[model samples]
Target: MSMPICIIVSPVQESADEAIEGRLHLVDSHDPQVPVTDLGVTRGDGIFEVIGVVHGRPLALDAHLRRLANSAAMLDLPALELEAIRAAVLKTIDLDEHREELSVKIVVTRGVEGTGVPICWVLSFQTDDHRAERAEGIKVVLLSRGYPHDIAARAPWLLTGAKTLSYAINKAALREAARRGADDVIFTSTDGYVLEGPSASLIMKFGQRIWTPSTAQGILRGTTQGAAFEVFGRLGFATAEVLVGVDQLAAADAMWLASSTRLLAPVRLLDEHDVPVDHDLTDTVNAALLDTAR
Candidate 1:
């Protein structure tokens, strides 16, 4: 079926019968609804993943699903109905009709009041500005994440490893960067360790070695970062996962923020100071990242 772009608040369970066709598609229905009581809505209790869709096919499907499952596990949500989620994503893409590059977002919430059943759905939309930024490069600023580097190990309940829907802080960080005339933010620990970006992973090139913020440092395990490192190794680059400092980023040969949709966007400036961006390395690494088909 078809419907205008609207948010449907479904008091009833979303069903396949409500599926629609358009520039956007909601996986089991045209409805974009969940009850106000849903933990995802009221308290931002949920896990989500955004995946790149190229030519109507989701890139690194299994890896994405694995991360989704891991996110859910970290949140202590129910075991994911993997096959169902997979079907929803594919169906959402198939129904979109336009096969241009897109982003598929999968979200699973921690159930509403009175019903332990989780809320899960897939939404597909046109790719965002990251596509252009990947080519033009971006300016970044280092901001404090306000946590010590080892907070994740010391306090597991912080959900540091999970990609939860509670992104108010992340968005605020980005907004603050914009206010400062910067394009994005690279978060640093309160104790002066480089963490990551608000929504992307940090990869810095120093001499012959490539480094990413360690997951042990309370950062999300960046799927794109891992994939890029594999590609980099194949391209004859040595890589490592380390605890980096904000000072190191300022002096790196080159740096980038990596994510599924953005792929890899080089940092040309940080904190209004110019980074010695290696254009050749940037282009080559970006090419390798794109060629990974992820």
Candidate 2:
């Protein structure tokens, strides 16, 4: 038999049904009741946000909502009843109710209309990861699409800021990296400046400061990266938002990926090179990052 899509939510034995190409249906406390054949999801006409659930509360809830709101507005999609969605998220969290960190995702799809399929799944998943080795860091590959226009746009496009469910390109990029025997891909501009990782913001240190590409670089604004920046600055490290290349980062004292769930993980290797961590800087960055997440 062909392999079933791996979008299943393995939260303590909950079941999954295919909801869309890259998503699945799972039981929840307050899940939405959309039809399984809704074309919006079947056609990738949707938006989503993967939330970090801690202590039963989703971290950066406001930020996720803000991004979700932006994506929905851009897609000309209807406003998701926030109360209903929040309830579903919280309900899903209660399903497994584990002690370790978990992720809860919210997906909003445009219901099919006319020849289109009808609306569907506003759902959440309790994601469990045992890869604490990530605390050390992740190795990433920098691959440039020679301007990235084929797969992405900086046009006055709504999807640019929206967490749209149309992530086929994103998945492809990561696959390319895996093909190269790497864990993740760092997409660069035609000019060789970094944009972001396939699913994260870049956090590298140069001199005595922490730096990430600015929004002018045309990348998703990362909440965890930003929050950690504030905490990094308060802890006496200078922070910057600038465009630096693979080589520039290679010269940095340390590197890491910042996101809601990982908090911080050092990047011990870059490309084919083994980039060692400057122990002092790593400690400072780790302490600063985890403290803020707490």
TM-score leader: 1
Pairs of colliding residues, candidate 2 = 39-117, 111-119, 112-117, 112-118, 136-266, 137-265, 137-266
- Alpha carbon deviation, residue 154, candidate 1 (Å): 0.7
lDDT of 1 by residue, 1-294 (tens): 242112122212345564333223243445447778998998899888888877667877778888888888889887775656666677666767553567778878887966776777677767776656776779898898889999999998998978999999999999999999888999999999999899999999988899998999878888888888888898788999998887777668888999888888888888868877666766776677666554
Report the Cα lDDT for candidate 1: 0.78
For model 1, what is the error of residue 110's alpha carbon versus the real structure, in angstroms, after optimal superposition?
Answer: 0.8
Best by lDDT: 1
Cα-based RMSD of candidate 1: 4.8
lDDT (CA) for every model shown? 0.78, 0.63
* Lowest lDDT 10-residue stretch of candidate 1: 3-12
Provide the clashing-pair count of each candidate structure: 0, 7
Q: What TM-score against the true fold does each predicted structure earn?
A: 0.87, 0.76
lDDT of 2 at 145: 49
